[model samples]
Target: MDYQTLIVAVDGKVATVTLNRPDVRNAFNETTIAEITQVFRELGQNADVRTIVLAANGPAFCAGADLNWMKKMAGYTHEENRADAAQLAEMLHTIYTCPKPVVAKVQGDCYAGGMGLVAACDIAVAVEATNFCLSEVKLGLIPATISPYVILATGENAARRYFLTAERFSAQEAHRTGFVHQVVAADALDATVADIVKALVANSPNAVKEAKRLVQDVAGQPLTAELIADTAERIADIRSSEEGKEGVRSFLEKRKPNWLN
Candidate 1:
């Protein structure tokens, strides 16, 4: 599909959705938000796609809201403003809940709303020199919509500091806070991301998809009979699945799984 603000490509089973608006540092305008939501929804339902990598071009992964878009929002009434914000919130949610494991290949600095993009991914690998900031508070605004994912990524304590201080932190700091999984030199970024992608693609697609859903459904839930029963049922259902049976047969027979072939 053609997109005015994105470059989408699929190689084998991996689909990459690159933010192409480098002229504006890939900032989020209404159009960018809409395209991201649309593309992710399509990719999530694509059986040929086993994993997705969210990437961006130029010097910044994303610079948050476009200056022009923000200017337009400045005059919107409360209802209009709420509606506009909802688009962004839903876009982030779509990425967070995508069935495929989305790995963020953050090759540059990320800021403001960009934080939401990184946080929504299942994994993030960033360049060592990249800087991250949550500067909404500096503009007399709050990171309201992105709060859920950001908090889950960086923990409540880290969010309290960055969300309030609006400080620009280094990639190491982001990794330390668990916001990014790995931080590598610029030259090593692509190799690192490719390695991660390769590993993801090698796994059983059904298992990988179910694992993602498992995490979402199990996290933060109280440990009780209901929760235990639910988890037991999930494992049982998967174990009885064709893919699961083949996985066991392949392992016992010393061969690659059918999916890999």
Candidate 2:
């Protein structure tokens, strides 16, 4: 699918969705939101695509809402604002729940709504030179739409500070706060993302998807007997499946798995 705001490409099992609006720092308008939602939905269902890389062009990863879009929002009624916010919420949810593991290649600065884009991904790799901020408060707005993701990426304590302060933080601070997984030099960004993609591609596709779902389903849930039984059942079910059988047999035989072949 063609996108006015994105560049999508597939090479082997890896699919890349790049934010293409570099001129405006790849900021999201309503159109950008819609296209992002559509692409992640499509890529999630594409059997040929195993891992996805969320990338951007230009010097900044994403600078939040497009200036023009925000200007348009200024005239909107409360109801219209709520509806507009819902679209952005849905867009983030799509990427967060997507079955394919997504790697955020944050090459430069990410702020406001842009931070949500990174937080929604399974893993985020940013350059050491990048700066990040949750500057919504400065604009007389709050990071309500992206709060769930941002809070999860950066703990509640960190969120309280950043959400209110709107202070610009360095890549190191983001890493220390556990927001981004890896922080490396600018030139090492591609190689770092590639290594992660290679790791994901080598894993069992069925298991990988199940693992992703497992975390989503089990995280923060109570340790009840029902939950324990559910997990046991999941492993039992997989162990008897064709892919599971092949995985074990190949390992036992000291050979590459069928999925690799």
The estimated TM-scores of all candidates read 0.99, 0.98
lDDT tens digits, residue span 183-254, model 2: 999989999999999999999999998999999899789999999999999999889988899999999999
- Cα miss at 23, model 1 (Å)? 1.6
TM-score of 2: 0.98
lDDT for model 2? 0.96
Which stretch of 10 consecutive residues in model 2 shows the poorest summed lDDT? Answer: 211-220
Candidate 2: clashing pairs of residues: none
Model 1 agreement with the true structure over 27-90: per-residue lDDT tens digits: 9899999999999999999999999999999999999999999999999999999999999999
Candidate 1 versus the native: TM-score? 0.99
Model 1 score (lDDT): 0.95
Error of 2 at 155 (Å): 1.1
Clashing pairs in 1: none
Task: Report, for every candidate in turn, its global Cα lDDT versus the true structure.
Answer: 0.95, 0.96
